[model samples]
Target: MKENGIYGLIAEFEEPDQVLAAARQARAAGYRRVEAYTPYLVEDLAEELGMHNTGVPLICLLCGITGGLGGYGMEYFAAAIHYPINVGGRPLHSWPAFIPITFELTVLFAALGTVIGMLILNGLPRPHHPVFETPFFEQRNQSHFYLCIEAKDPLFDRTITQEFLLKQKPAHVWEVLA
Candidate 1:
């Protein structure tokens, strides 16, 4: 079914291998934008689906470095340049003094970035998803394996896509409602 520019197709598999095989077939058939849900991780599914590496970790790293540098810069500016407080003959730029706060900020930013990046990447805080409308999908966290091909696929058409999914020989295939 299609709604709000999102199209859903449901395919069920009796075993993980079947799901993986279906994913491979879908990939060979030029279906790229698809998602699979399973109770457990499937080793070859990601590769079979041609899902590429994500940049969330890289974003977290960059944000962490920025936080560290920002912390250090703030300390440098406050103790060395902006205020220039020389207490008890201590150096204006106390590298050791900046270590604690810099480390703390680095970790804090990295953690915050990781969380925010993950939420953003995952489209989280979503109270509802079209996939949930599939009655069989409740077993997604149990024993079933499901693959959904979104309507956004350039080559997607309900009839042809359903035919292709059936060719995969899934145990049961149902339409994912929009």
Candidate 2:
């Protein structure tokens, strides 16, 4: 279905098993830029397609640590240096008093960082994707599954990819146009 310049090749499947098998086969063929669209969740599909660890957790942890340190630092500066109001002759640099705010800030920054990191990693805020251009893309909501191997994949070649998808025996293979 090469209507114009190719973005990639998309294979439509009638069943989850078919798409899953196709994905596994694609991975075995060394296709790294494969993606799958299904009406419902398909177990192990992500793993089969080679989706794995990302940096979101690391980002969250770093943000949490920074927030905890910042919160503690702010309180320390205010109590020990900026204000230093001695309450009941208690220590002005009381670290125990800073625990609550530090904990809150750590949780807050970690949550915010997780949300932001996920959005960025997923390439969110986009209004369109080339797969949407497929005339049959809407079928994805009605029990169809689609697998796409993007042109950006190092192993991608239009003819070769199309033939490869054809070998999977999909319902039909379409060229996803950019």
Candidate 3:
């Protein structure tokens, strides 16, 4: 546990199903700070770990609306308010002329917002994590799966958690240090 220098304990399994089972068990055991790592996607594993909803979609929607309004507003100000120019006898506040720029800005802002929001939401730019120190790739096949119970979990106790993980019958149980 985080009581000392321990980040948590990580259990390595040979198959995806094994890690998935361990994740479910850990969740049921009241470990809230659980995390899983696998060679590929295991969709059900995320549900078991309570990693469902994210705010990236809301961020995209808000940013898209802002970009569209901003683009249209800028065009209106430039063409009608700042310097009115009636080309071809068209009205100064021609909204049709603003559509292309508004559409482009909406898409651009949404895409950029999605990326930035995902990074911020996921705590990205993490050059290093405690799990990275573990020998996950070393001592076994390349397709191993790992389930970690972080010390931040309220139910974490070094001795008891170690015993619990042993009961899961993992291929290997490692004490991950922070």
Best by TM-score: 3
Candidate 2, RMSD to the unseen true structure: 2.7
- Candidates arranged by TM-score, highest first: 3, 1, 2
Backbone collision count in every prediction?
Answer: 0, 0, 0
Best of the two (1, 2) by lDDT: 2
Q: Candidate 3 lDDT, tens digit per residue, 105-134?
A: 999999999999999988998988898877
All candidates' TM-scores?
A: 0.88, 0.87, 0.91
Error of 1 at 91 (Å): 0.5
User: Candidate 2 clashing pairs?
Assistant: none
Give candidate 2 regions above 4 Å deviation.
Answer: 1-4, 139-142
Residue 151 in candidate 1 has what lDDT?
Answer: 83
Q: What is the lDDT of residue 89 in candidate 1?
A: 98
Q: Best candidate, lDDT-wise?
A: 2
Residue 54, model 1, lDDT:
68
- Measured on C-alpha atoms, candidate 2 has an lDDT of 0.89
